[model samples]
Target chain A: MSSSTDTQGTGAYAPALESPRSPYRRGKPTRSNWELHGWLFMRMSGVLLLVMVFGHLWVNMVAGEGINQVDWSFVAGKWSSPFWQTWDLIMLWLAQLHGTNGVRTIINDYAERDATRFWLKMALYTATLVVLVLGTLVIFTFDPCMDPASTLEVCRTGSAG
Target chain B: MATSLTPTAKDGPKRPVGTLYRGREGMWSWVAHRISGVAIFFFLFVHVLDTATVRISPEAYDAVIGQYKNPVMGVGELGLVGAVVFHALNGIRIILVDFWSKGTQHQRKLFWGVVVLFTLMMVPFAIRHLTFVFGH
Candidate 1:
């Protein structure tokens, strides 16, 4: 069949005939590579989230005094250490990115109109950015003993203020 | 009277419209992620506020948390746990969709698979959490 087609094309060719133009050329730049990177990020973040989330749970719910131990003092004590602060920071960033990218994909898929897609994405990104910034700030700027003077008597006992 | 004489527009093509949700797997992954994200955000807000109670007074903190020791709150905790678990698991699904060559083909299957796995994993974890908190 291949030989017959070759012979037909060569021997019976009309020299004056023009080739048909393709309707679909390489149109727009491909975005698949960027998408692939996003996909990879989801899995890596998910795996890391698994560890960070579970570790958080274990420490708060399973270890030491268990759930009862999780009070203001408990959080204050935990955040006082750089270890817990860093852990929380990692969790916050990973979860935000994973969640944001996931939603961005959704918005791209569901929002039909260009304006709708643009607005929704703008809102999503804005909200994500705000929350991430606020959360990181809180984690780093946390102060357990703010009113040290007025509440010194109570603070001394590790209960009141 | 005018309504009865009007002709209806015929359905155009069988093909769906819009770039949004064109891929089944990608669409669903996007959905689960958003749902989970909102859930986590609200949860974090409450958690931070709850922790802030300690700043007010220890008794207030204890009282707020003491309420969480109840059955209803235990159930709520389970819901939170479920949200976290589903979000984390589906995140893996999103990652697979990105990295795998055949990910598009298997997207639907993988999405559902992650959902099933999330439910399976969360059941025991949630139960254990509730038991630890309220079973006493």
Candidate 2:
């Protein structure tokens, strides 16, 4: 509001190229390595999530007959296989934990009060725990025939259980 | 550095005015990365809840997933794919910048590279995906 200079057009664009100086570079910084671990984990899990998520989408929604073919039995059949179960379980864990950590970073950066940060992260962790438990149970405990109301033909004979 | 900053500072009234996109490509890329990250995060949140229907009866589970087949939801699925692709691609770019010595120097170039790659991957994939959803 104080000025009218249009340096954007008048001067050559000088891109900010240098990386920010590390906090540890200053005098006697007592640094814990937790953030370093988190940073590395993001990259590693990102690589894995890309593969698992894409493959999950491909197999469940894209390959074979695609979405219309996805029924209760389709899911039951998938969970019945240990490989697919593990695939889904890993994907669920990686996505949830990675996302939770990402939001945690945001919360820490912006939340001004200790109580606000504490409560927000507590809520986030609770939701993440609930989802993780639910996803894990769905992947592992799934039994199509065991569901009493299943109308799928595979469940008719009760042998699919 | 202290002496150099003094001459660059214009008088109070003549100072630089705010403009759109004052930040460079890396900052904009960071903004996009967070937006896409949160999109994918919330999608997974809802998706996990939806998948929990598997614990319910088959009738109940089918009732939930059946809506996803609608063309309306197909459009949402496309948006989901867009978020996922951008997040993943930019996630890689960030990884490079963090761990590679040369990556920080070429961060802007890396961002444009990601945008081009995203276009290449999305266009054909989206066309084919939509054909399946609405073609029937």
Candidate 3:
């Protein structure tokens, strides 16, 4: 339906495009609704991140003596419990994935050239994988009593410390 | 034949004057959200790396983290708190804009609400955190 209006050159009134709600399927759903799912995940994960991140900030930067209290012993005290371990593990995964997707969107928008876009995303994904793995391992394998000269309560007991 | 969409002075009145979203609260909030999100993401990478130092040795971890207690990094932490606060609040606004039926209609008002909430939360945090950082 190339009407006269549709044939206008630059600096002319735009032609009306097809409605997004149109029933006609455009070449079988290719990406398998990945974009839709990503959109939903951003919202869902965003809400969770707000809570976890705020709690983290409060505990580490606002409570007690604040940042000064955050030392190896402080970390040992927190991670010694399974609860904080789980809290941190989930927080790590959610925050990383959420941030990665957001950066991926930015890369797609600004990196006009295909090679630039591809390499940017490649770097992002690589960093994401590394961070996730390292964070996870740290949470799981953390041994508060690893140091023989440690004097933490848990370390003194020769336990989680 | 107009081969390029770029409007030139030759086009006269046909050239667009300004963007539709420029100078609007919604636009500003959107810009702030993007900037904050990017800043937070980069910080997250550094945070993870620094935290991994715990696995090395307590002295190493303590030495590295001690840098944050310095005045320079203390101010940097304040800035980071500002970014995280804005991104978190604005993200909730975006969630409402997407899910609530009347969200788009009130998006401007919601952005202002985000600003107000950010200010409220940050004031105490700044006072408390700065005290801890500088008190000792």
Q: Highest TM-score among the candidates is held by which one?
A: 3
Reference A-B contact fraction recovered by candidate 2 = 0.59
Which candidate ranks first by lDDT, i.e. highest? Answer: 3
The CAPRI-style docking tier of model 3 reads medium
User: What ranges in model 2 sit over 4 Å off?
Assistant: A1-31, A147-161, B1-22
Off by over 4 Å in 3: A1-30, A149-153, A158-161, B1-20
Model 3: fnat (fraction of native contacts) = 0.76
lDDT of 3 at A108: 93
CAPRI class of candidate 1: acceptable
Model 3 TM-score, 2 decimals: 0.84
Task: Give the per-residue lDDT of model 2 (tens digit) for A1-161.
Answer: 21233356665545534356624345665998898889888899999998998898788667877766787878887876778889899989999999999999988988999999999999999989999998998887778676656665667774665
Pairs of residues at least 3 apart in sequence or in different chains that clash in candidate 2 = none
Which is the leading candidate under DockQ? 3
| Candidates ranked, most accurate by lDDT first | 3, 2, 1
Residue by residue across A1-161, what tens digits does model 1's lDDT show? 23434565666544333236524447587566788788778777779888999799779876775665776567766776789989988987887787778778878978999999999999988877776877787777766564454333334676543
- True lDDT of residue A101, candidate 1: 82
- Native-contact fraction for each model? 0.27, 0.59, 0.76
